[model samples]
Target: MNKSVFILPVIVILIAAILSSIFIVDEREKVLVLRFGRVVQTIDEPGLNFRIPLMDQVVTYDDRIISIDMAAQEVIPSDDRRLIVDAFARYRIVNLERIRQATGAGGDQAIAIADQRLENILNAETRTVLGEVTSGDILSTDRDALMLRIRNAAIAEASALGIEVIDVRLKRTDLPSQNLERTFERMVSERQREAEDERARGREAATRITALADRTVVELESDASREAQIVQGEADASRNAVFAQAYGQDTEFFEFYRSLEAYREGLATGNARLVMTPPEDFFDYLRSPNGNVAE
Candidate 1:
């Protein structure tokens, strides 16, 4: 029984040691094997790796690019205008041993430490580079050039941490909270001014159209009245010429016709009464067919 117990313990230890000595590095990972707190080997190839059990420590780091988001910061440009700037950076670990040395930590702790340091470097560079340009440039297409400058500056600083800064980008920029209200007020005032100008123009157009319509109406009415008067005058002239021609043809018959027309018009009223005495010639047309006065 004592011999069996010793053999089982030996087997267990061997198994544990075998498992501990073997490490698997993923395709996206880089590993460091450390002996007694000292880096003994750096493995970047993906596959099964072996290390001395109980004597070596394995630290793994991602080999892919990582991103770090920077907090929003206030920047004062050359124009003395303040801007709220938010930025981010993409980077990859270039040197594992250097990163462990720079961070003074191994494994995942080193990545965290490196990211924190890089964020600080990026923030400082963003401020420094943006401060050199005017606000217009920061807010324009020239912003691409400014971001390139920030990335270059960050790369120089990040190299100390064994980080390769691939790119830097300004994500969002806006006026500060206190300035936003004032900007909105200024914009509202401008819109109101434009609206008032448009209304004034509309009123002017309406007035012009109304005046034109009134003048046109007056012109049309005056022309129609003149035409009516001309037609009436022509009709009266033609009537007078007919009367004169009939009078010249026979004066006695013409006089008789005029008397008969006057009588008919005077008697046409509903309740008309004659109040004056008529001359003898007035009845001459009724008394004689030739309209001569009866002697």
Candidate 2:
């Protein structure tokens, strides 16, 4: 019984000793071994790792990229316009030794320190770069280029703290309430003026077209009137020519005929009175029984 008790205690002690010496370093984690509170070696691979049990210590750090969402900061533009700017950054640990030296050990404190550093860098750099641009530039076409420049500057600034900034993005950019309302009003007025100008131009065009149409109508009517007058004058001249030709064919009859026509026209006029003697030449043609006047 005494021998078995001694053997069981020995086995238990050996197992405890093995468990204390052996430590696991996961694939996604990096372990730093410290001797006398000073970092001696860093184990970056997975599987079993041997340490000096109670004398040596292991410090683990996550090898994954971390995201930090910065709070909104009020920034001023070159035009003296105030805007709220919100941004975020993606960073990862690049140098484990530098991270340990800067943050000391691990946990929330290290993350807080790194975040503070990143925020300071972002604030300082953004202010300097963003201050050079006017409010219009911020709200217009150059915003993307400005963002890229700021991101690159921020990455460089944060690199010395063992924080490798993978990407930086601006989430929101807002003008002040007063500025927004004023801008909206101005835009509305501009659109209204443009619409009014378009309407005026349309009216002017319509008037011009109407006047041209009226002028054309008047010209056509005048041309038709002139053509009608010319046709009537031609028809009258043709009738007169036909009568003249018929009269020229018989001279004596034409003279007798013209004398009778003249007498009838003269008597038909109410302003004249006809009183003729019976033996007069003008009445001789009427009195003669053979229808011939004496010489």
The best candidate by lDDT is 1
* Candidate 1's TM-score: 0.69
Candidate 2's C-alpha runs over 4 A off are: 1-17, 77-81, 133-144, 239-295
Question: 104-206, model 1: which lDDT tens digit per residue?
Answer: 8866788789989999999899889989989888888557889999998888789989889999999988889999888899999999999999999999999
**Span of ten consecutive residues with least summed lDDT in model 1:** 276-285
Please give the lDDT score at residue 87 for candidate 2. Answer: 84
lDDT of 2: 0.82
- Which numbered prediction scores highest in TM-score against the true structure? 2
- Model 2: per-residue lDDT, tens digit, 165-253? 88777788898777899978999999999999999999999999999999999999999999999999999999778768868897666
Residue 32 Cα positional deviation in candidate 1, in Å, after optimal superposition:
3.6
